[model samples]
Target: MANQEPRVLIAYGSKYGSTKEIAVHIGEVLNKAGCATTVCPAGEAATDLSAYDAAVLGGGLYAGRWHRDAVRLAHRARRSLRKRPVWLFSSGPLDPSASEREIPPVRGVRRIADRLDAEGHITFGGRLDESARGRIARMIVKSGKGGDFRDFGQITGWAQTIARDVAARTGASRGT
Candidate 1:
């Protein structure tokens, strides 16, 4: 085999596009770490898994469920992914309470992680802007269940960690 760095795919499903940005950030981090990376919508990507050595899947959570495409991709690639490294993430949970307690665990990502033997799973705070929300989303915001709660720092930190892990894996595999 050629001594090329492993390829990393950051596939994401975004409703209002926040998750897409997060995936882009991850791709940037991986690229800086010397891996060939691609960031794309999960539904739009080719389903063949043989080309990637590592994968990161991200999505938006709506009413306790991940975007459909994310779920479908994970399910479709489950068998093949079991023999490789995979990471899962969701962008959701905007709690405005003053307490600094961690956001409650999302059952969907956990279930997917268990099924795929994912290296790690994460849930980040989501955003809610009444002006940008749709009818139902606006109603939910008006109902007192929404706020802008995204933490860019935490998201970037997580991406950094993932970069390091991917770099380490590629280095080890290449005996560098």
Candidate 2:
């Protein structure tokens, strides 16, 4: 495992694309850090984790729960994910809270993290714009409560941490 680049899967579920962008950013960081990374939506990711050495899964939070697709993927890939290093993340807070301090996973997400024995978890601020779908989403935006709050620097930092952990665990460092 130390001789070759670690293959990492980054799976995410997003409602309005912000979370997808976050996942992509993470993949880029991991790739630059010497890991082979695949970033895909949770629903599209393969259920088998046999091909990857580690995984980072994230989802958009909704009504205090994780995205359905992400939750389902975790259930389907639990056994395989358990055999590898797994990290989880949530993006849903529409304020600066996520960047200011640690946000514990909601009940459902916490359960998924526990089941997968995740190496770590994070909560990133979310984004809501006028283009958001659904009545409630539009209402929130119309009420002037929605805006992009994701912190890319914080996100990049977290991804770098995961890359280091992966390299340390796999005994391989691609770039250095």
Candidate 3:
């Protein structure tokens, strides 16, 4: 199976669509790098984790919590995720500082990733559109916050690293 390329599943939960966009972008980067990838909302992803050789799981952070669906997906796929390569990510900082240090896991979310032995976790910047804001969101925006903080270059760079790791582990790198 040295020649077999690894398959990846990208699962995400988004309260208002930011995380979903990030997940899709990750999938695109991996696919372009020669991995087969499946993208879906965390709730709709397969429970049979073995179907994917690796996984990239994440969701938006809101009110110091990971989305419920992201937690559920992790629990449902726990066994498989533990046996394979898994990475976790969260999109939450309305601030532009999306470095790993800024991307703290919300409440109980860290425990799930620790249990799954995920390889790494990323905290990317989030986007807030004023037009889509509810009254509360509007208030937050009015207080001098809220805008698109997502960086496509940063997202693709991380996914590219994952692609390299997958190829190395599976011995599936092209031009070999």
Which residues of candidate 2, in runs, are more than 4 Å off?
A: none
Per-candidate clashes, comma-separated: 0, 0, 0
Who is ahead in lDDT, 1 or 2? 2
**Which should have the higher lDDT, number 2 or number 3?**
2
Per-residue lDDT tens digits for candidate 1, residues 118-140, read 99887877766676457888887
Clashing pairs in 2: none
lDDT per model vs. reference: 0.78, 0.94, 0.86
Better of 1 and 3 by TM-score: 3
Candidate 3 residue lDDT tens string, 39-118: 99999988887777889999888887888999999998898889899999899788878854456676577798789988
RMSD for all candidates, in order, please. 3.2, 1.0, 2.0
- Residue 78 CA error for candidate 2 (Å)? 0.5
The best-first sequence of candidates by lDDT reads: 2, 3, 1
In candidate 3, which residue ranges exceed 4 Å CA deviation? 99-102
TM-score of each: 0.84, 0.97, 0.91
lDDT of 1 at 75: 86
Mind giving the per-residue lDDT tens digits that candidate 2 earns over 1-176?
66899999999999999999999999999999999999999999988889999999999998899998899999999999999999999999999999999999999999999999999999999999999999999999999899999999999999999999999889994642
